[model samples]
Target: MSAPAKASADPAAPGERQGTRRRRHKGIAGNALWFWIFVGPFVVGLLIFSYLPIIWSLVLSFFEAYNTATPSKFVGLRNYVDMLTDHNFLSSLGTFTIFAVFIVPLTFVLALALALLVNQVKIARAFFRSVFFLPTACSYVVASLIWKLSIFNGVRFGLANTVLGWFGIENIAWLSTVDPPWYWIPLVTVRLWLQLGFYMILFIAGLQRISPTLYEAAYVDGAKPGWQVFRYITLPQLRATSVAVLILNLIAAYQAFDEFYNLVGNVNYARPPLVYLYSISLGSIQDLGHGSAGALILAVIIMIVTLLQNRIFGFGKAGD
Candidate 1:
């Protein structure tokens, strides 16, 4: 009773608190409105374009759908069975597997080497980066055309053949010859050129994120200046980036279509799954069910491979 009035009992204090709460609520509502304004379109677009297509494709894979205007009949797993037994589909899978085996390691090593080289440069770093990365900006279709018609053309005067001529070697048909599958040379080279710069940039970003103090500590412990430092420190730090690059490279290799389609034209020797599926679904007699089934199978294979890679790499683990 004799004590001074408490601060909480002040007449103005409750009104001030209420005013502050009102301001906070208004601020939160305004922020929420802005967030939805910015993000709503993207969410709507993803649902309509990406997720919906995936769902529809899954549904279509179960039916006996063709290119005709007639309604599709449900044939359950027949399309999937046909895809499994199809010779062309099997050949395409084999072709893609071989391509992946070659391209994955080649790109990984070359990209890492280029990244290391570029990272050590003391001048014109941006210029060097741009030069390496410029090819990636070129369309696959355009690049394939250049490689096919200009560089590896079967004629005696083609760029590759001309270079061989200078060395007293006979002109080679780089694309059409299948006795030894010489087409692989141009395909591999073009893919390497197109993708090397991208992976190099990724590695460079990974390198930059590595703490310099680790290198300093290694030096203090009498570590050597070159391979030892990289072997013991740099490589370990790049594990995550390496995993990502490998996975991406694998998927890209599996999905390879533009280069093969443009370079080989109508040849059936080097077709990948997508090319085969395209012929099935849209070429001649269209079979949308078989195409959808093959697509889902390819998607499953990619998913399984990626998961296995992640498990092997221990990706997402705290120390990894």
Candidate 2:
């Protein structure tokens, strides 16, 4: 046994394994370096532009930062107290609540109707989709302006008044009269026009995701063509999509500023939370502290509402 020279058991094996490991380590390091190189700037920018501003705003909210962004004259929770107690702000919220109640359902139903109708069309489907979706590309500001100046300018020449004139009705001041709150008509319509198309697209996507086999099975079970199938199958299938649309609609209703601001202008009755906060921040008050406090409060309210909606709808659950 001692005479048998021990064969060097793959003498290069250990060195080759070590070299492979070195190469792997170098490759890993290179990938890591490249990742950081690409991602570092975005991270830095987010901290600087988004997070820092929020932190600064929070800090300013604690102080008397009137007409300025910098924190000055620490007043603790005075800004929050004043904002919460402000009658005008509370009234605006009340009005907004009524508006939300009206708009959310209207938009949901209209969009769903449009989606169902569009989904039924076997020919020129893309053309219809594009036609419906074109409004979503429109600027809210531009839409507001058109609705304000051309459609419902509270003048005899305005489109709405002109339509009424043809109907043997008097040319009514739509925006100018707060007594009837007729401004809501244009506000609601413009928002519907701008939003309905986008939501229709969402519904269309949801509709497409429904398996045709389900419909076939329903038909086999003697389900009717329209109402019965829709009530029993289509609607239930679109539950998640409905929840999402409702949530988005509610939030958008709350954030309605451009239309209110452009159309209603300084009308105490029509100012939503954003418009009210805008006035507080940029108006004669110029109270940055109060504006920041209001914004934070609105954000908290929106978050709570969104959570409640998710809980009620079981948004992310498998069954939902």
Candidate 3:
């Protein structure tokens, strides 16, 4: 049939193909430009503020530096040695350990409990959530002041003492009572109040993610409605969130400063590592090398603890 009438060359097809390639090229270029535009500032800021400071501190830690201006001498490991041998540093570590031990479990339990309770509420859920979370909006410094001046003030008229007075107990020095560390009342309470809602929100988000079908299945299997459902279904399902909350609480506890600083106001007994470092570096002494060394040491301790916690929780496992 005349070679199929000499099949007509389709000029439109080639044009369409070229147009598609050009569109794709433009799309890729636009995406790359936008990605850099969005991420460039954050990357630059992180390097300038976070990574640079960490590197500079590490370098300073190895020398006898003062005020980060310059190294007075090449002390090698002397700064680390001094920090390790210093009694005050050791005491701060012990204090932080105790605080973390108490605060971590307490915050985890209380936050989970509150989350469960709030999740169960049939009415006014948003109101209750806001009420619980409002305190977190307050600055730590302001909350510490409120706790110190209004609640746990050493005076007879303070709220805590006034309540005790109603119970026929005399006013007590809540902050100054180092004999039994009654300062922990304000310190721990403020921290709990400031932090509990945040963790509770985490748990609530986690709880919402759990499949309702799992609870139904449990119920059909004769699991009871309340704690049984939670124990068998909710708690097990919340492993990741729980681990995160616990680790965060642990780190916060170890780094505690504002509450203690404001409530105790420079007392020596209950200082955490940050406060100790501050006293040495910027406080009266101004020893930048030892401060940097202590900070690095504390950072190592926190990292170790976090890794151990992650291991215990089996984080990064396939199913987890």
Candidate 4:
């Protein structure tokens, strides 16, 4: 009778353990259900809106789609062939290349300089920072329009012309001529004004993160305040930030469309890749096939460049 009672008690203990496991499993299942409830909509939306379009466009690139919903035929790589050989397309690429080369370094230098200056300001720093960063909130289209209509317009009353007139220079049509390529002035300045503050903010953050004790130690070892301290301590410490800024600058340069389009408006000169591809979508050249091919090519190029930069720079890692 004692053995039977003891065995019956042992059976209850096993049942209790099994019951606890079932409760734990139920709790886990309930938590998982809530997690899916939160994240499922966003994931589904992304797939529908973003990923599906990308995949569809890729398939569209392979077909002879000409201003139609359904593709006419599978033309293989002919669209890509035509896109690569296009004169307007080639020239647009050249324009992008030149713009990237000039703007990347210029923005980097100017942003770094502004960062250094702003980082040193002890009083009214927030005021100066806000003033500089306010331009970033302005639309590129608005800025481009302002530059075109008020600042760099060919009229003598234009700000740039008025300033130049003081030096006895005649009013020049900034966006009307390809001979002098003066359109680049407005294009470059508007972009710089819009973007510089953002990069400056980044550099400022990078600067703030540097330990003050390093500078103190350098001072104790007879390192002077200006270039010596900057070159050895500041510059070296900012390598990661520099790489990030340069990568961003390069991508921004290549993706430039709003300023160029708003400023020039289908002009023969200085048309970027986006402008050329867009032109293909409108007005006498509505070949959707080739345009899709060009877009994919540009996308691939951007992806490749980004990957290369990441591989070379080793972002978020310890630098040599």
Count of steric clashes across candidates, in order: 0, 0, 0, 0
Q: How do the predictions measure up, each by TM-score?
A: 0.89, 0.89, 0.90, 0.87
State candidate 4's TM-score: 0.87
Candidate 3 lDDT over residue span 102-172, tens digit each: 88899999999999989989999999988888888999999998898998888889999999999999889
- Which portions of model 2 miss their true places by more than 4 Å? 1-23, 33-42, 318-320
Q: How well is each residue in 22-125 modelled by candidate 1, as lDDT tens digits? A: 99999999999999999999999999999987887788889988884243698899899999999989999999989998999999999999999999999999
- Predicted model with the maximum lDDT: 1
**Best-fitting candidate, scored by TM-score:** 3
RMSD of each: 5.2, 5.8, 5.3, 5.6
Candidate 3 lDDT (Cα, 0 to 1): 0.87
Per-residue error (Å), model 1, residue 153: 0.7
- lDDT of candidate 3 at residue 69, scale 0 to 100: 41
Candidate 3: residue 91 Cα off by (Å): 1.0
